[model samples]
Target: MLNLTSPILSDGLTTRSISCPNYSLRGFVNPSSKPRPLTAKPHQEIKTPHLSAVAANATEPLLFSSRAHERDQKDRRDQKDKLVVIMGATGSGKSRLSVDLANIFSGEIVNSDKLQFYNGLEITTNQMTVQERQGVPHHLLGEVEPEDGELTAAEFRSAAARAISGIVSRGNLPILAGGSNSFVHALLAERWDPETYPFNGRGSICSDLRYDCCFIWIDVAPPLLFEYHSRRVDKMLERGMFEELAELYDPKNDPGESWTRIGLWKSIGVPEFDRYFRKYPPQKTREAANRDDWDAARKSAYDRAVREVKENTFLLAMKQIEKIQKLRSAGWDIRRVDAAAWFRSALSSPDGDGGSGGRRCKEIWEREILEPCVERVRDEVFCLGEKQMTATYY
Candidate 1:
């Protein structure tokens, strides 16, 4: 009799004999052309059970059943769709955090900032500078034209899904970062719709319409935001924001001919022009090119530009912050950073302005933006489990 518990071998002979050590048992041996184990040491030829045979019968009810296999497949399917989403108020250092996290996680940063989507308004919109990208790969930035006219959050999410699929295909993590909170969540929580085609023959398997990732929200308090806004404008002026704006605004030309100014005031033309002009005053033509007058006029324009940019930025920041709060309360995973703290710190750091003051600015970012962002990304890694997690999770 075959022992079902014993390992299956190619030979039919059982390893355990029926005869006991104390009691001898006699059995009739069949005489056939094939030799028995007792005769000529079983006339051997090297042989083994075929692995293909075992595999072929693996799904049979005799050993394992297809139901268990199907269950495992379903479990894998569930895990495959899991995704992470990042959201926050703009200028709260979401981009900086995302870029850093992308480095550690070996993931690509997917642009969720609506302003970043446009191509022409690169400097005005403050899209990532080429040097700032540090040779790191990115997706979805500068793909849309300014003329596209108000690309919705829904549309951005759709583009995101396609980007995600391609990233997944390459076995890389997709770091969804930007200020478009609603759009990011919509992709993670929504079901796939047949009509929505996000990939357009790209490697992505899903439309940008899907949302299926963890959500990370960056934020700052209103008071801190106001301070940060003012300082950021100051930094921008130092970076020649006034010069850039002046080049765009031609007081003498028709409005249609100029580059559209981005951000709060929208443009630098007409009726409500005081809103911007007060901060970015135009220069008066000098009777002659007097160096002192020209220097003074330029300085005034820079100062005014700083003030205008700050005021408008504060208003916009407040509105964005309100949205962030609502999203957080609604059960989204939101991580907030004190941008004012960061701005203050930046004001003091060597990279910021220059020495003792630079240290203060750097410290503020450490307390507010950098530390919080690092913690948020770490939490994501913990959720995925450090053993199975890759750099992408962080």
Candidate 2:
């Protein structure tokens, strides 16, 4: 409001002037505004970028998604593609636990055990029955063609990637469960031993697919696992294990144990029983009911074969444990679910009927193994993620 007297001093400045454009330095002020002279203190306009409301208020790690709906949808899709691997040595109850996880999580089981992938000899392969699955959808089981030969690890990765993508598209979890370490590893890791697989290591042997994987290792001590293998062999015999072995490795027909020389045909039960087949020669021994000495010798050979199978299974289990630990070292997310205490509790507890003990074991499993796993998947994989990880078994 510098209503200065006109022409007081043409060059004299007023104390201050604002909104009084009727005067200037020379006469009142020019009717238009002009720049004020600079001073020692500077005036600056401060501005800060806007932050997301959720992020600004959050106390924990924030999971960020795009502002656009389409980007949100893509984020959701990526989250859904998370892969769950249930892995362990032979007779570690991987299949059983996998079924439990899948059934609880609305997941579909993908067979990773190479033997279970074969269509023939469901008995020898130790395939789980529909009842055993308890209504969970399973994939890749009994899908392999015998004539296709052993599927190379690379081919398995391709197939698994496709299956996982398809499952995620349908809004279901893909649960890969079995003992096929290299095959499973191929899908998750960039590098693997190509020599072990059917394909030669050409170039990088890399699969272009990747997934956020949760690897669950169903673990048991070696001695306990060997006992399971022995008992499983005996049960297999009861369920026509030798018959499948006979068909797969008949000494008279194939003669040279050619199956033993092949790749996956060298699976656990295959090699151990090869010698037994040669010695007893299933074809000759099957009709030897009239000879006591021959049957007795065959019985001796059967025990020996079972013992060898158990021993080899123990060795294989050790290798599997070693491999699993190695994979962990290579940054694979591995969590071990110990079954020893649970088995002991379930089998030897009071009520002896085992029903209550089995139920208790299930409870322990839910509390210890399943819940923590779901939390890990939520925190690590999803961030209270789009998939809405829920308690399945409980």
Candidate 3:
């Protein structure tokens, strides 16, 4: 069997390897041999062995042997072209799952989230914090263009395709994770013949690269999902999302550009939150209302803006679901995993009087939702990389 704990290390992290069905019934191989505990090794290069994809189906294969694996690695080309598509609506925990999956499979994250592709809107876009990233390498986050140009779907696919190739060439998985339906659809879509149909689409599936890609669709129960989104927006506000929007506001822009200072003003929460920044002017309005003995009026306006954001975001998520169905219709492989299960699992954990309970709850969430979802992907898709598969969770 291949050794994962050898000299190869990932920026002070271990890239745990998995075995086929024989390694465990679930296709996981825990590297029992411990290498020297990793210390700070900044600027050190990571060396990982290339893993070839074995034939996948109902059929079983021989147990892993070093000689056999080495020979297969030399002869086969499938392992060099694996891709993980982490997608779903906003508030469904796509970012969290991508981070966890990348850690397990020694993968890098390629951001396809359209808003995340821009700069200076990190909090507004719900960009994953560095601490939340868990030390995995992330590419294409905040890769904006000069002069605030409008980024087309094709442009993003080109960038993401390059990033995917580099990750695979390094013997690591390439995880395309985000909720940008347009970008995801464009990247995985069937190659279009522009001469035959110039207007339909110019999107390329990049089939020339021979990637065996599968979509891990993270979902949340609708009722619970709305609550999740509301709480998430509240958290964003607490973290100064309002201030971020205020900094980017410009009343002189055409009413058509009511979103923000730049072209990406159409991002999910931006348009909805525009009211709070423009007409409502929360803090200023509050002070003025205090003089008139109507401070609650300012609070009411802010509350209305928050409600609109929550409702509009829900509508946006529903539209995304429709778009995803179109991809499913076009025969893209997708696996659905529910995030409400994780949230419920976390909430159901024992509670305490202090913030300790909240921290412990997050631990429960990782153990329950995040880790298992990645393991399932390892077993059902990545380990058996040749299958065109689909599974649904509600």
lDDT of 3: 0.60
Off by over 4 Å in 1: 1-72, 80-84, 189-212, 250-306, 337-343, 350-372, 381-394
Q: For residues 1-394, what per-residue lDDT tens digits would candidate 1 score against the true structure?
A: 1111112233221112221111100111112334222212222454666977777777754445699788866654544333445666657676666676666545577787666665644555667887788666777787654444555544554566666655655544567777654455445543433344322332222223233345566665666667655666566555655455544444554335433343222532221333344444545322322436556765575456456656766776666666666656555555554465555555446544322454455456556665555555545532322332222222
Q: lDDT score, residue 55, model 2?
A: 75
By lDDT, the candidates rank as 2, 3, 1
In Å, residue 124's CA in model 2 sits off its true spot by 1.9
* Whole-model alpha-carbon lDDT for candidate 1: 0.51
Reference-based TM-score of each model: 0.62, 0.69, 0.68
- Against the reference, the lDDT scores of all candidates come to 0.51, 0.61, 0.60
Positional deviation of residue 275's Cα in model 3 after best superposition, in angstroms:
2.9
- Per-candidate Cα RMSD to the true structure, in Å, reads 20.1, 24.1, 11.6
